[model samples]
Each structure stands twice: as C-alpha cells, then as structure tokens.
Target: MPSTNCTTIYKLVQRAEDDDIEDVGNQLFGDGSSTMSVLEKKKRFEELYGVVRPDAIHAHPPNVVKCKGSGSRLPSKVEAAKKAAVKPPRRCGKCHKMVNHDSRNCDKERSKKQK
Candidate 1:
C-alpha cells in the first residue's frame, strides 16, 4: 500500500467512514493541501477506487445477538467463584506459620537444634 502514491491512497481513504481507513489517508498525505472537505474526499475516493468503498456491495452491520448473552451470573456460581479465589493459609513445619521461615532457615528450629 505504501508503494502506491500517498495522494492516490488518500483519495481512496477519503470516502471511507471507518477510522482505520481515514487514518491511512492522514498518515500518507497528511491533512494538508492534498486533503479536502468530506465531499471532495468522497469524490477523490470514488475516482481512485472506482466505487464509494470496496466493501459497499456487501456492507451490513453484523447481527451479534448470539455473541452477547443475557449478562448475569447465577448467585451460586458467583459464590463458588468467590470461594475459589480464597484459600486457607499453609502451615510451615519449621516456623509453624506461613509468615516467615521454612525448614532449612527457621530461627526457632535453629535454636532448638542448638540446644
């Protein structure tokens, strides 16, 4: 796409309603003399592409009802998730608590061994 003239590409993008397409025009020619009002952009875009837009023939908003479900979690499922998120503290054999030392480095264990 970059190999083509920026002005030519800008002409194609001018008719595009999509942000991504418009960005291509802005990136190439910039918003300078080559750029124009919406009407001019549309005209140039049509001339360059030989159509209003390439996808104009098959353009339709997607019917996405299936993708978006009735957004809600059951109370039991929610409670299960909460329970899964929490876990009891682990007991350390040497230090007796999960807070500090383990078997090899426990200060209490060291003291007992010294005795």
Candidate 2:
C-alpha cells in the first residue's frame, strides 16, 4: 500500500491533471469566462472520455479509522486522531522555525525593503 504522503500527492497530481483538461476544454469550447468549476469540468471530461471520475484527491483526509484498528505497536486510534487533529507543520524560510508560519511567507520577510 502507498504511504499516506504518497497517496496524498497522487491525489493532488490527479486534481492537477483534471485542471489541465479543463483548461483545454475552455480553449476548445471558447466558453467565455463562464468556465466550469474543477469538479464540473472533471465530470464532463469523465462523461466524454468514458473514464471514472477521480476522487477529490486534494481533500484527502487521513484514515484515522485504520489507526484505530491496529495494535499498540502501531499507534492507537486516539493517538492517530491527535496527530490528525494537530495543525499541519510549517517551516520558516529565514529563521527556519517550524512554527505556525514559515520564513518565506513570514511578515518580517515581506516587510524587508529590497536593496
């Protein structure tokens, strides 16, 4: 089975592929700015191509349920739930602090006047 991160990334790539298809559709149909949302575009593409509609990969929520079923050597479901509930990790670009916000997007960096 794929690691959680790998599964998540796969979903993101699939969504991106869908987005690219939608862009092409807009070009072909010349639908002036009334373009379909990603979900709608994906549905249309699946219908036209006779392919399965891919899952919402970007919205890939972790499977805390699996953690629940596994034994103690594997973290308990409660622990998995805690990990899932915790805010996502962020790395700062400048100070490199793995705090709430990363350095690249830090306000301090944004405030710096370029020489």
How much is 74 displaced in model 2, in angstroms? Answer: 66
lDDT of 1 by residue, 1-115 (tens): 6667887877777756577767767754467766457766766667666766654476689776775656886579878868756755466786687643466667775687799
Positional deviation of residue 102's Cα in model 1 after best superposition, in angstroms = 34
Predict model 2's lDDT versus the native: 0.72
What's the lDDT for candidate 1?
0.67
TM-score of each: 0.21, 0.26
Local error of candidate 2 at residue 57 (angstroms): 44
Clashes of each: 0, 3
Q: Pick the candidate with the highest lDDT.
A: 2
Off by over 4 Å in 1: 1-35, 53-61, 64-115
Assess each prediction's global lDDT (C-alpha) against the native: 0.67, 0.72
Candidate 2 per-residue lDDT, tens place, 49-111, comes to 788965565676776555564664778899987986797867877767665557656776556
Q: Candidate 1 at 96: error in angstroms?
A: 37
Between which residue pairs do clashes occur in model 1? none
Looking at model 1, which ten-residue stretch has the lowest summed lDDT? Answer: 27-36
